[model samples]
Target: MKKLVLSLFIVLFVFGTSLSQIRPVYAAENDFTFTVGSNGATVTDYKGTDLNVVIPAAYAGTTVTEIGRSAFDTYGTGKPKITSVVIPSSVKVIQTYGFRYTSLTSIDLPDSLLTIGSSAFENNPLTYVEFPDSVTMIGNYSFYMNNLTSIKLSENLKTINGGAFDTNHITKLVIPAGVTKVDSSSFYNNNLTSITVLGNATTFGTGVFAGNPGNLKIFGIANSPVYAYASSNGHTFVDGTVLFQAVVSAKSLLNSHLAGTGVGQVPANTYNDLSAAYHAAMIFVDGIGNATIASDLDNAAIPLTSAISAFNAEIIKAGNPAALVAAITAAQQAMTNHPQGVNVGQTSAANRSTLQNAITAAQQIFNQAGQYLQGELDVAVAQLEMAIDTFEDVIITAGNPTALGAAITAAQQALTDHPAGVNVGQASVGTRTALQTASNAAQQILDNAGNYTQDQLDAAVNQLNTAVQVFNAAVIQAGIPTALGAAISVAQQALTDHPEGTDVGQASAGTRTALQTASNSAQQILDNASNYTQNQLD
Candidate 1:
């Protein structure tokens, strides 16, 4: 008896745990979206042409995964407009071309996300971004055409896809040392005035800066042979050129800075003019690879004094040590030279070579990944085209508008041709108006029931009506796994063709309407729908 009781208790416990795991994931369903699918964490919905979404980390009644694709499509009016958005970390895969043309000012991503899909958030109005260290793969065109004046990338980022932030607002650039390729058009058409590479920057593609000003300044690793092609455009050459400029305007900056690190050191108004001139000179001098005191700090009083005291002393000690060293130390104490550390020293101290090498590596990795996905893309594109063709055939073959139920299968196949990472825009779809016209015609045929015998007329009209209901139900039932399964199959087949290219999936709006028509037809023929209640079955 005791054993049986314990066994029953264990079964109940397991059942409770299973139920807990099956919690519902809510989303703003079909009212605004066309396709909602299972992603890693947050369920994703696609509806708008170019998906625009505002992902709220939490919603009271709505599931946090409520942002739908094409939910903000703008439908030729342009992108959807939004003030700001806070993306949840739970979102791992943001699909390809997602948020392509939206008017969002800013976005903040959470840590849980690992992959940001290709071309995701391509043309947003984001001005500033600070990527988390956890992000490794940055998809193609992820930040292209943004209004970013400044950005701080994560150190561990491995790959950056093509056209990443192509037309940004940054004036100066300091690409890190870990990145490999600074991909083609990655920084094209920007207001870039200065660029300094950190390390051995190699493998730059053709016309990387095709139309930019020839006078643009470029700085790279010392003795680093990369970017020799830059000279072809008459680009200005600086040994270590790129510098990280603050994105924020001076008005937002505090006027004060703590100075002096030792016990006797005192905090000074380091942001004042006194520090300005000193800091300027420190950066002006290209003093790398030399033991001598060559620095931009010659114009700064404090820095010049410090340099004289330090450099001259070292030289003096090896020669006329005693008197010269004492004189230099005294001069520094009197603030004879504007402190060099405040001026040119600040800029020159940074090693541009190391950062450049990093940027190169990251780019290389991204290109490699792209290479892997190329073949996949080719097959997927072809399959998508075929799916559309097949669907059109079905619609044409069913000459009798009342028999339009078969179009649903063709449309489903069309969607399957290219599943995820694809968009069902106007270009890839058939005409919804045709389907609607057919639907109307079929209904008209049913309405003219008095011309035939009771059973014959009823059978014809009932089947026609059922076909219409089925079509309608299909559009409504597109969310159901059964209907979506057939659609995804075509897309998965496309994926196999592109074993080398990236995986992409698409859902067509035209096909969606056709399926809805079939569902509506089926419902009318049956006189009732099993899935919907009386209020909906009608």
Candidate 2:
């Protein structure tokens, strides 16, 4: 009789509804349905119909430690509905499918929570989620099909299983540095504009961004795993410092034009008149506050208007009607060549408006014998330069050195072909040479692959392994383990394809040892990527 009763209980436990009869323990005082277990207590089912449900920290003096599987799933019956949930600090685990297919638009998870079971909050309408620092693991499909626009990951987060944040409206993300392992599909099909990974574990599974747009910008330290992965896989790697420097350079180039002899062979006295405004701009740019780089840049750009006004007055006094017409024509030309062309989006539209305003203002003054100052032309050119920098940032994020090299070569060839239109100066020559050199280095490794002796392949593998160390360090710093997973996989496969002992020699033994070490390092990166700390892996 006991055996038969046990069999029936097992069947009932496997299905959710039967658990209610086994414990009829409703803490009427607390108005919650819970069952006591070895550890403490778990909320098995909710009895309230409030759209905003708050799970209590304790019921009947036992801390509510878990939310049972499918505890809040409506099962498509819609008998019970909830729009928001507040999880308490005492609850540690949320079991699988606990909140799946709900109308929930908001949720509050406490730091005490450690794991979120698969599909726990899938198909919700959540716009944002803030993971508490205590969270370690987020299961597969946990946040799948949500309308998430943003997510705040915990510093201690370890593993993010496949499809964790797939199909969302996420525009930007910062993967915490501690994350070591990420399933390739974890972020699949998301609208990601930028993703910054703190770590570089390289065992990325195939199709990591399969359904997502390919224009994702990856930011990380130079010579890091993020760089290697992005470079190898043809994603743009935004070198943080380099990009900032480019911004500074663009501003400086604009400033240089305003510094000396007011634009284009002006009357001798005009220089002195523009000097005051020029000096002010220089001082402002030099002592620019460090509140925010972009804002500071804009602040520095403001004084350029004063310099242009001073120059315009000079043109009016000189009565240079022809120069005024030329200035207006230049502004029109600038408006025509606006850096961001058609179909570029809202930012481009705004830029276009600003450019048009500059042109329109110049034109209004043109009929009054107003000449366009060099400062005004410089400002327009500066805006175009900034736009070019933006394009460069995107290209860097694309991270394909081969394509960059090809583009560089094509540009150089174009200059050679159209010598009259294109000026291939010293700077251009230097840039071309540098690009060619880097391209040759990368291409040599790829081009000679078929002819590589076993020993040569071993050398190449060693070099790649060295690159991996840099990636690992950056990954740990960034704390994103899954970041490097795919890169490591590709790199390791390349090394493994080379046969052993095909070209064993006097130095082959040493190469073999080195290869073994590299192989071990690669494996370690994969093994500890998702959850293990460096100390644990070491």
Show model 1 residue runs off by greater than 4 Å: 1-39, 46-80, 225-229, 241-538
lDDT of 1 by residue, 348-456 (tens): 1122223233334433433343232334333433443343333223221112333333443443343344233212212112333343444455455445533333344
Global lDDT of model 2 = 0.60
Candidate 2, residues 1-538, lDDT tens digits: the string is 9999999998877776656556422223254578899877888776566656777778778888998888877866463657777777888999898898888888888879999999999898999999999999999889999999878887688888888888888766766557766676787888875666645452354455556557776654467666776687677766543332233333333444333443334454554545554555444432322122434444544555554555555542223445445655665565564456332121255655655665565556554433445455445445544544443333211112343334334544433432231121222344444444543453575454444433444554445444333322233221355545665666556456544565643334466567667767867766655444544333
The 0-to-1 C-alpha lDDT of every candidate, in the order given, reads 0.46, 0.60
Q: What TM-score would each prediction reach against the true structure?
A: 0.36, 0.39
